[model samples]
Target: MIEAYQKLWPNRASVKNIRTQQELEQQILIELNDELTHPRVRKSKEEKLALAFSRIEQSDLTKQQKKDLVSLYKKIAAQ
Candidate 1:
């Protein structure tokens, strides 16, 4: 669990008392939000693309949801 949290936010400080995957995930989100707010840390375009691709692949979304996601991804990629 700690390892998962560390993997999720490698550069952030180590988190303790995060036992389950869900808690680790929530802590990682908090860390990500903090990083996003900081001007010093900017996510690259490729990183954004990777995140988008992960979102498309990670969930059990419906068929139309997947199609809509792909269409949205295409629009973003076209920009």
Candidate 2:
């Protein structure tokens, strides 16, 4: 019973504390905001994506078309 409990409740040394999706997103948002505000840093990944999306939105493309274009643009930018 004690061994089973030990196995179920893993030690901190054995278990990694991974951030949840929400936590990761918040962290990324903080980093992006910092980069956006930094004068020297200029456009970060978030900024570039946002600018691209904005440009696509301004174009004459339909809603779905713009979304598809933006998705492709993000994928390429991620590379």
Candidate 3:
């Protein structure tokens, strides 16, 4: 990776820093790509995840589904 970075940089010699402008830009692009792969977050999605247990709290036969839902909601909330 370092070798490739040096090859892409025209002023490799003067660039004493480990990460050049191009390398930094590439890193940002990689991170953006990763974030973009996830579906865009929406207000409704947040609202729904926020109310994870509200409806189910009073419902019966929700034990197993609640475990799955809480786990799923936590995962979404984290992102």
Local accuracy of candidate 3 as per-residue lDDT tens digits, 1-79? 3333333333645333546545544442333233434456523444544443454454443466556545544544555
Note the Cα lDDT for every prediction shown.
0.53, 0.49, 0.44
| Model 1: colliding residue pairs | none
**Candidates 2 and 3 compared by TM-score, better number:** 2
* Winner by lDDT: 1
- Model 1 agreement with the true structure over 29-66: per-residue lDDT tens digits: 54334454556776755566567567656656655665
Candidate 3 has a TM-score of 0.33
List the candidates ranked by TM-score, beginning with the highest: 1, 2, 3
Candidates' TM-scores?
Answer: 0.44, 0.40, 0.33
- How many clashes does each candidate structure show, in the order listed? 0, 0, 0
Off by over 4 Å in 3: 1-48
* TM-score preference between candidates 1 and 2, better one: 1
Report lDDT (Cα) of residue 29, candidate 3: 38
Q: Arrange candidates by lDDT, highest first: which order? A: 1, 2, 3
- lDDT by residue for model 2 over 6-30, one digit each (tens)? 2322463322232454443343344
Q: Residue 73 in model 3: shift from native, Å?
A: 0.9
